[model samples]
Target chain A: MTRLGRSAGRRPSSGFGDAPEVVVEHAGFFSHLVTRSTGRALRMEIEARLARARGAAVAVLDLTHVVMIDYACADEIVAKIVERTGQGGARRVLALLRGVSEHTREPIQRALARRGLAACAEGTGGRGMLLGEIRDRENRAWEEVTRLGRAGTARTTEAVARRLGTGDRQATEALETLTARGLIFGDGSHYVSVAVMARADTSTASADDE
Target chain B: MSRVLSVSPELDHQAFEALVAELPDATRSGVSILFDASAVTWVSPYGLIGLLALGREVEQRTGKRPMLEPPRNREVSGYMERMEFWPAAQNVFQLPGKQARRHGDSGALIEITSIRSNEDVHAVVKKVGEGARRILQGRLGYSKASVIHFSIMLSEVCQNIVEHAGSLGWACAQTYRWQRRLGREVAVLAVMDVGIGFEQSLGARNASTGSAAALEAAVLRGESRFKDRGRGHGLQAIRRQVLEWHGSLRIRSGAAMVGDIAEWERRLAAGAGGEYAPDRVSVKTGLPPFPGAQVMIVLPAAEESITPGPEAA
Candidate 1:
């Protein structure tokens, strides 16, 4: 059984034909997760209802309450929508994200852009919030890697481990793999600044064929 | 005067040592060695770095850097780029020819055009790997790891072609050298094909995602255009390897281009460092236009090896 609920306000719409439309309010990380799981359920329910109603069906993900968003949840929601609508072609999936801040809205916008899905965050009604602090951690790691180069190897590994909340061995292994491939070079001592290695060489012998 | 030195598998090391020994006593005031990589079938970072170290030594002694000829093998070039030694080498040597032109200098070029199926992918990769090992043994007098990661990258790319490139098509790889500059050498490797463009094969994910997204996804390590259950880490792995190793990765798909690591770096340097931006180019497919993907990997000269820190050793 799916828990379907609606925000306060608005009279019962007639077109949906008794398939309860769930309205999502308050977008945070947890809210986003609930919305995604709920969205999946709603999509199935709407499809079933449409089959019974003998009419066209649609799923509207109203992010009017979403205050923030991050990459993982944004990817999950957008990917699900794109997959269902693009592949299934059974229901019209519309995203009504509103009232989100620019900073919070960017990742979703980017994902949408990549999928060729048109969406905009407008005013206070459209804001979506990112949960779990994943984006915050990723940005910090990128910044650290870009600043310290190989000298920051340990720190970068530690930061990534902390961000992913995974074991340190995995992170260290990743770093070692990169080093063996000649992507990041260091003597395994003090960290060299990223400025030197960051200006990597782009031209060589590989550009001949196409 | 440029010279071509061919040695048997057994004499490879002896030949390299002889060359290095001869360097110190050469009558020429400034000696710049230009490796005729066209004839050399394979190479690796360890082998390459050994030769590069010798070149560095020569430069230190005579104030002239030895030059490395571009690799005639695309697989070898890919590996070089991943090591990030290609561009740094460019600072010391002349640039190789652009696109598909044949080498004009007096060196040999090994053309690898025998790739046809998934099985062939393995064979060619192994052949290239062995060839690189042989080259290192003959030219640099050193042997490091036998396993080359580029072989893995090549296998994945070739597998993609075998499984998807639509019908039967062939692949070619070549390497060569330019000239010595500022006491260093520049080498290059170029790979081309006549198959379905990346967009046609990967763009099927979502008609809306288009070819560009497919290309971007291909280079993103974990993203795969295929719905198959296997790890779709081929191109993504290649991209990360290239970036970390100090090389460049360039991809072309029928009028749409994505995955230019150099351009990415420039954007990063310019402080426009969010996600990658798309740039459109006019491309032609083979059915009517020239359709297919051309991947060029450029690597600079290898940096001098730093003495391992006490903590690392």
Candidate 2:
């Protein structure tokens, strides 16, 4: 079970409900991330913060303020974190990139693609998009979930299966795959997008192994 | 008696080989060498850094500072001084008289700077980034994105010296007007070191593979001496960006050189019957054995600013 503990009595103004999301704002910390050593330093700081949070927490890496990021920094920070997050350690931290720009996205994409890993990023209009490798079925399922969010759907397996016009088993497999990759979170029978998790009220937010 | 070697009139990438070829074998000990640059009329960034490396090599081997006869041409000497060459050279060359004071409009985009650690690389980027907007954007017509790429490229090249060379090195950049030939401005960047080169750094098995094969493996195939996943991407990315910009890049280590020669350079080479026509394998090899690596990058002006010169007719 995933329980949120760091609720600082502050509610998110984005109206998606205040989930106890750990936001690691990097723009204020670094002007640019260009070298391997600098990347390693930032990665360690992010890892330390993730380790402090309770089980199965979603961490938003806000890159809006960073000026530039080179390949070394991208590989050292983003790729390493994605690789480690997928390892399913005692404390699982899912990463969601926020405020990625055209200049910074290329290196991040290349870094993740090289390792055959993928991470969810906040796209335009607060929707979620995959940044690295993804299969067609997985992508379709993710798109369906985000599409349902347009109408305030709960993103349950049965709802996704009805939308994809596929049977419940295939849809369940797709959602489960996304959840395993940390692109989405599974709560018993329903899946929640990271976009929602970033704002969901932690008092009611609970993710289960299913 | 000290050995005397005359410097080439036009010091460049190709001339560096001729310079090194004049050195005595590594086994010759305790014989101080004198570099007579009294006749050198012009020098490229490669030539400048290569001289430092050569001086360091001689000093380390002979345990005595190499004696350098300053260039006789006042213009050449002035150019060197303004580029901050004398300050760096003081560490490697022994002058006969008082060191000349440097005061002038330095034509260099980035002055000769030593690369000993990562902080040096950061300083280079910061120093160059300040003036790169005016030079790369205003003169060369490079877009903002291109300027950023150039900074990253510069950072990676300097990092190679820190990460791979295992010794000290120097880096410099200057803008040159190819008025007679290309009628365009090109930014020339050179980075050189006196340390373990590709053949030794790659591993024991590659020790005998020679510099050409090792350069080909590293630059073209992106093979690194390290087995890490992200290792060796710098050179490959540099090659791609240089090609996309229609520029020229050459790397020389040990006794061989490998390069992506631009079309204009190839034409000039063919016209002059130069050894670097890219037609023969031996052309890239058979240079005098030298330690460490020397890299040269020439980025031409963007297409909008390019125009054929009188020589083109």
Candidate 3:
């Protein structure tokens, strides 16, 4: 269910109704030696505009034009943009990432990983992956789902729920999210990450049988 | 009688300019030189290479063979012995220095070693990037972005030594203060190989026929020895980077030599005095050619710079 949280009394912080989307055009070979000051300026613009617009917005950082991104510059630009723009928490702007190539995605992923933040990342070529945190409560759910890999288990929602002590609904959400991010595959009734699937093949054919 | 050119203990790139500065007039004066290495402290790979250039300059101008007075000190001479410096100098001047085995990396100019494979190229690139980064950032004032480009440039040049030369090669880099030309600091990266020459390599790929056309096409047009897509941008990228930094590129292989003297090569076709120099200028020389390709790239101090922040280092 897509429920819209009301922001009548104050500015909507996060995971809410239609927010303003800002496009940040990336330029050049985006290098560690080349930190874009404009990224910081864009975050400030969001902060200042949100204070005036008096509501929440989602800032989609468009890096389609950026040729290359090294690790250090990626951290300098993206992490600060995410943390300073009120996307660090709720009641401010949220940061979403789009137009990442395999070349650019690595450094961006490393930067987000270092900050313990997550943003929706997608390349212009249609591959999307999740990194850092998801705004919803199912943010850390994938850890338990991937942990099932060590036991060499191919699990259904019920099995994962039983193993992780989460409700069936939570397990289903976790499995669905993991599948969407291409981290796991769903074979009709069972969910299996690659290692778990490999182990399942040797241990029991039950995954295929079911 | 040959004039004696005293060799400093430190015959590094830092001293190369001042050493080379008097050479043009000295060689023009048409005197064979006696390169005295008696009181030398150390000689980097680039320094040895510089010594080779000095020999070539003297021979190319006066046709008189210069001789070397090897360092009297046992340690300095041994260092040269380990570097195979004498033989390398002998290659240019036809002097008397023993030909020994080219040894491993000695931390002088990204190591004085032969590149055998892609792994060697990567190792050299990593070492050059790490060791030279401080010089580029602090001294030459290139942004980190430019430094990455330089890394790619170095890798491409070194990789060429393996892929195209078809023979073992040597690569080295050093930062020097250019008091004469630009009067600022510059970083010079030189890669040389004693293998099948450019004309042969390009001809083998069915790209061009002769040494002149092949040398011109390979360096100027960035044409590769393979007819594959997404390949052969090393020299071209280096050329563009040199343009951006207002640097220079000089390349000599086989019987054909092309030099762009706008720091040595420039962005536009213009070489020096606003005269249009083609991407490559083939000079026919009678001097016996080196067995492989030899390229020297000079990146001048950046015209524009930012005050590096505390975290910049």
Candidate 4:
């Protein structure tokens, strides 16, 4: 399937069977470039890919074509970047985002501020070490939460606390927070992890080893 | 898998933490806890803060929040309101029923007519329970335990209608919405009956007693005169369950308003206890102009759990 066609639920037409990657080209306006459902799915797909990237040295999120942005999609994208980059000793993410509105860009910058990824600007050419550190830590933190959630017992608060290295109160509070955010769900005794939010898939720039 | 924890009236911070600690990790991370505070008429700030801290910890670990179920006990709601936690709780959980409605704004009007046969009480309870569960699930995504608790409270209230409303009159349930200043959702469930009101319900046992005394007695554990007959314990159970969840309950019978614990306490302290008297102690009042009783229940959304860090001293 073509990149855009793959996203909107179209089957692969021909010769594209070997293309494991999906890429969506951006149009000028937000509505034209990203629909709500497609935007969400894209964000999830990006995060999933990053998770699977494991210990790769660099992860590139190329968004350099034309574009407009919605707040929800923007927030999700920023969160993913911040989270992925925050993990220690993980692959650094180099975003190739272009034509981003000032309104959308400011929040993204602020989110990356604490992570040391703020110094790396769009189209900065060559790799930046600070960005890599931030990306690695963010990814590690996210992986920790996911790993703990998957391995922890779902029936009792104590089990969750132990996995997270927190007290019962903190564990319960964290559970509450996660539930509100729609990251996890529970049966009587156990919790099931749901898919993370996804935005759009973009063209791949070159893979970089920092 | 369905482990039940029966907390006593003497629940302390340590005991509460231990109970929470017993839950499984995944359940701890994802489960939505509903605190039924109706039974707890009074709460110390220290205890309340401890609970809040637990809720916070849960959120930080799992990144999910818990929903706080409103207590049907007026005293409990009053206590939460005094602590300024009521509005925050409502905002987080998005309370169900009457409190869900926007304050000062009216929405769809639903009228529920309860057929006053003792046998139909169960059916009515089931119907109300299903409706309530659907609404709550849609709004707050509560757990099965929370839904079951809600069902229990609804069933008890319906049972009261069957036993105390003279077995013949119909009870009406109305749904309304009013906007709250805090932007927290509020839905109202008002159940009214044109039967023997609270005065008569209580007076049937004692000729000179008022609605306040009957309400007080009804809510207290094991205070039912009909304990042998299997009728009065429902209200007490409802009161307890509601308080535990953090909901509010208001009852009006004849010229008497008996179920609002906050109002009752204020009046009693202000020396208005003797002036406002009812003729009977039943769930209904037999007065001519307004001959029935109306029970208005306000429930907040399920509560979010908090997990405090070990470093928190």
Best candidate (score: DockQ): 2
Per-residue lDDT for A33-146 in model 3, tens only?
Answer: 222233344444444544443443334555666655434345555665555443322234444465676556755665666565555555677444455545443434444544
In TM-score terms, candidate 3 sits at 0.45
Model 2 error, position A44 (Å) = 2.2
TM-score of candidate 3 chain B vs. the reference: 0.63
TM-scores of chain B, in order: 0.49, 0.90, 0.63, 0.48
Q: How many residue pairs clash per model?
A: 74, 5, 14, 135
Q: Report DockQ per prediction, comma-separated.
A: 0.01, 0.36, 0.02, 0.01
Candidate 3, residue B244: the lDDT equals: 63
Which residues of candidate 2, in runs, are more than 4 Å off?
A1-29, A122-128, A135-137, A146-170, A200-210, B26-29, B101-107, B204-208, B274-283, B304-313
Please write out the lDDT profile of model 2 over residues A1-210, one tens digit for every residue: 012233333333232223343342222234566777777877877677667654456566666666667777778878778776534532456777777777677778877887788888764345467898888778878877655442222446766787678988988888878877877755443456666555545334433212
Candidate with the larger lDDT of 1 and 3: 3
Give candidate 3 regions above 4 Å deviation.
A1-210, B1-47, B50-111, B263-288, B304-313
Candidate 4 true-interface contact recovery: 0.00
TM-score top scorer = 2
What lDDT tens digits, residue by residue, belong to model 1 across residues B161-264?
56556433333333333122112232233343445666677665646354556566565434655563222544554565455444456665554455434433
Judge the docking of candidate 4 as incorrect, acceptable, medium or high: incorrect
- The clash number for model 3 is 14
Quote the lDDT for A24 in model 3. Answer: 23
User: After TM-score superposition, what is the CA distance of residue A135 in candidate 2 from its true location, in Å?
Assistant: 4.3
Docking quality class, candidate 1:
incorrect
lDDT of 2 by residue, B243-272 (tens): 767678888888878877676666566666
Chain A accuracy as TM-score for every candidate: 0.33, 0.75, 0.47, 0.35
Candidate 4 structure quality by residue, lDDT tens digits, A116-152: 3332223323222222223342233233343333323
Cα shift from native, residue B75, model 4 (Å): 35
Compose the digit string of candidate 3's lDDT tens values, residues B1-313. 6677777778764455455555656666676777776777765556666666566556656798777776677776666655556655655555554545556643333445456676676566556655566677767777876655676567667767776777666676656566544457777777776677788888877756667677778777767676632245456656666666666676777656666555233323343356654433335454344456777777777654422222222
